[model samples]
Target: MIETVVFDVGETITRDDRYWAAWADWLEIPRHTLSALVGAVVARGQDNAEALRLARPGIDVAAEYHAREAAGRGERLDESDLYEDVRPALTELRGMGVRVVIAGNQTTIAGDLLRGLSLPADLIATSGEWGVAKPQPAFFERVLEVAQAAPARTLYVGDHPANDVFPAKAAGLRTAHLRRGPWGHLWADTPEVVASADWQVDSLTQLVEVVEDARRSSGS
Candidate 1:
């Protein structure tokens, strides 16, 4: 019946990639290099904290990069506008009787970022707060438990295939892959990757309609 809709914060609900660009600019490294470093750390089976430790060089550079980028961009870097369509989208879903929630990997700084963007604080569920990250089945399980929703009745929308689509599908929840912007590179270009998802949409505005179709097909 799609009673609950869970979202990822960073790239899904918020424009965090710009921050990644800021990080890349600060570190004076190509964004792809930092991404590769992060992927290598994860491939080694290290948790987020350990991965952060292993990727400290890239992380440190990214931090400095963001500081300088923020300084240089000034008002242009303001993310307040990012939340413009987000709230309206959620409101539309909520009006359809869907329970909106967030399941994301974020640190404490995420709170300030959400507040600055005027996102509703109560809608968030972060790894920093829950002590777990995505690509782990337990993370989705925990969010389902908190939302009091059954796997079949929930939908998870995210950007990454491994972290977002695969895990959510593994947990038995329908997944919507948001493939907007340059983040499209995160998906595998094979048929298997293409066939894994229940739905794929290029924009968040398309999500509500997808869910509606799922509901109708399920005869809910």
Candidate 2:
């Protein structure tokens, strides 16, 4: 049975509209242009941040991010960023006695912002805090350690196939590929994603039922 549900941040528990929009504003470009470039990079399996590099060639994206922070215009998160199903679904899972963790490839600031939201989770963490990011074996290893459970009993849920599904599965946890964000919907029907995901869900509410069904099947 699944004892722990670990979620990804961007495009999983939260929408990424503000993230790309912030970049568009920072680059002084139309949001659509940067959004289109992001889609293009995602289509080609390139890093999503490649859109920023494409917007301003030879620009140091990291340096610009620090500059934005220095300028008091870095990442921002509020309740508006979360999906509608996030609160109720997470609360219900916790109520059901399942451990819920929010772990993703986000920055330290984002982690702080998320904690400020007071989402119903056991722990919230990010790559900036852990010094490891997704698709890396070490990242999933940390997730398993944080879970405090056997990998087989931990479920790692996210929208990205490469970063979420494959690596988490390789790390021995059950994988749930959520079909919500761009990467989620775009690769939802791909054979590899279908094969890699132990559970393919469109929303967090549906994920609750998955865990419930698992419990029944396992007689837990």
- Identify the candidate with maximal lDDT: 2
lDDT of 1 at 40: 65
For model 2, which pairs clash? none
Candidate 2 segments exceeding 4 Å error = none
Give per-residue CA lDDT, model 2, range 197-220, as digits (tens): 999999898988999999999998
Candidate 1 wrongly placed segments (more than 4 Å): 28-84, 120-122, 185-189
Task: Report the CA-based lDDT of candidate 1 relative to the real structure.
Answer: 0.68
Quality of model 2 by C-alpha lDDT: 0.95
**lDDT (Cα, tens digit) per residue for candidate 1, span 1-220:** 6888888876677765465554555456788766666556545534433434444534563464356646774113245536355777787888888888877877545644565665542466678778888878889879788767888888888877777878888899888877743343446454644787777877677878977887898897
